[model samples]
Target: MNRGLRIAVVLAGGLAALMLAGCGKHETAQATAVPAPAMKPAPPTPIEVKKEEVGGPTWDPEWDKIVELALPPAMLSGQVPHDVKRFCPAFYGMAEDDKRAFWAYFFQALAGAEAGLEPTVQAKHAQPEMAVKDEVTGRPGRTSGLLQLTYEDQKRYGCDFDWERDKQLKVGDPDRTILQPKNNLECGVKILDKQIIEKHKALLSASGYWSTLRPGTVSYRVFAKQMTNVPAACAVHNARKTVDGTR
Candidate 1:
């Protein structure tokens, strides 16, 4: 080939190599421009309990701490009962720690009304409907514990109460799973979750598991009084549907 033709061929090959390098650089720049995916927020810390609302011959102040630790992660999540936010709008804006504190207060109030915060108190009902026999003990069905749960709750709500082992122990024994404050309160959370979240029942429905949560019942009055002192962060100013009974 002629010299001019040789020079033209070399220049063309060099230009092609530069064009390929430019395309490679463009691809690398595009890859580096992508943004990272967003991260989910961290879960809330455990609640710190300070006091109780109920005092009785059987009430134990230590049960308050058990209620605090017994609360599950879901309870502190956004899935909290709408009635709570409806009655206390401030609950929507409160920090995770404050929300946890409010729920701890709520259970304390409930235990106060249901069993006077008595972890081992057993109550028997004479009303024909509620006077059923205890399936585990073959005796009359009686509500027991800080939340007044029965051995049947183990089947109904998958509670941790073990009557077979507990029967060997004397009554009011702290070793009884039903009488343990943490077990009783955790089971209470599960029951309330099913009622309000799964069953879509009102928090204060007459058909609720606990009569203390049912509005207009004499026991509900006791629960209402305890709610009067919910965490200040709740900002429950108006008489909406609350322990104060706007609900």
Candidate 2:
């Protein structure tokens, strides 16, 4: 009887060990399992922020954020912003072969100061425009586009792009002809040319016109210090219109 009891005890111990082993295996499997990472679009490469001091309206953090989103390194290059057909229509229209390159660089730098190459920028807080009717929905819209052209500029340039004519508008719905890249650029270039090339009012007006370029102003100092490319930009500005003044 004692021998039988010993055998039964051994059997029970073996069963317990088997149960524990099974549990260990289950735990191991659970521990090792992992979920796969979810798929997402690769984010755009980041541009380093220029940290410099300048005086003007208090810096809006939003402008930096907006610029980072819109302006890529490629867009800021003189080649891209200086292009004759696509980006800078102003360059193409320049009759003077002598100043074309300088003009392109000047405009590129100005773009950095303005909308950061964002064609659709509205300058919502600064320059308000006449509320024009949208031809499709009859909804009222205001000034927007590349160069942030204002309602005054639209009328000034005599740009009338009826939405009905453009089936392939960039935003899918036409904002207006003034807000379109081509129209806004045409107006903006003509104004720029008239200001410098035609009127010869001096390029200083360009720097003075935009607070960002005004010297000794907080914005100017900030741009000078912060924007790594300021020297290149200044070189272009000075080369083109130094007698007019520069930051």
Candidate 3:
């Protein structure tokens, strides 16, 4: 009689424990479940701000301002392109004083005359027949850059001028690089220096390299007008290193 009673009691106690644990699990499920929010997440913004600013030239207020102020707008029609084909080697190799005073005016005039002061636009010859074709694309490529650096000039100067548009877009593309005035203007001044010093053309103002250098042409007038403020030593006759270069 005692054994039977004890077994029945143990079975009832086990059943009660199981019922209690099932109720606890139901309550825990109710407590943990959550409903979703009504509103959708907002879209990300398109604006992107870089931590560091891309580098550009700290244009010299001293000489740069003078060059900026001097050039007249009427002169820049791309009719007379600046002779920037050799600008990279010529301008970079000149004396500092010559660079500041005379050469800047000379080159800027050519650039203004050639490209109308925009680096991206190519300079075109006023005469339709005289335009030179691009070596790469076989399309007639116009002169480009602040110096009216031509397609020919790019090859002549050893600057980057890729024939493939995609390749040029990636490397040594003058259209992109010339936009940087630091590179364009710097190379322009040097290229002009080459005409007088290296080529022995003897005339910064009258070099046969650019028709603008010759007197009586509209290009020369722009050159003369811009030089009104330049020192007297910075003239066509004195542009060369020696008189022997005049030939």
lDDT of each: 0.68, 0.40, 0.44
- Best candidate per TM-score, number? 1
* Alpha-carbon deviation at 65 in model 3, angstroms: 11
Query: What total of clashing residue pairs does each candidate reach?
Result: 1, 9, 10
**lDDT tens digits by residue: candidate 2, 1-247:** 2323543554466557545655646766757754321111111111112211222222222222222222222232333323222212333233232123333334434544555545556543432322555344344544455455555553444544454544355542435565555665555555554444444443333353344455567655433433333213134344445445653
Per-residue C-alpha lDDT of model 1 across residues 207-241, encoded as one tens digit per residue: 99988888888988888777766666677665354
| Number of residue pairs clashing in candidate 3, backbone atoms closer than 3 angstroms, sequence gap of 3 or more or interchain | 10
Candidate 1, pairs of clashing residues: 241-247
Scored by lDDT, model 1 comes in at: 0.68
Q: Indicate the worst ten consecutive residues by lDDT in candidate 2.
A: 38-47
Candidate order (TM-score): 1, 3, 2
Off by over 4 Å in 2: 1-98, 126-143, 159-176, 206-247
TM-score (all chains, Cα) for each model: 0.68, 0.39, 0.45
- TM-score of model 2 relative to the true fold? 0.39
User: By the lDDT metric, which is better: model 1 or model 2?
Assistant: 1
RMSD of each: 21.5, 23.4, 30.7
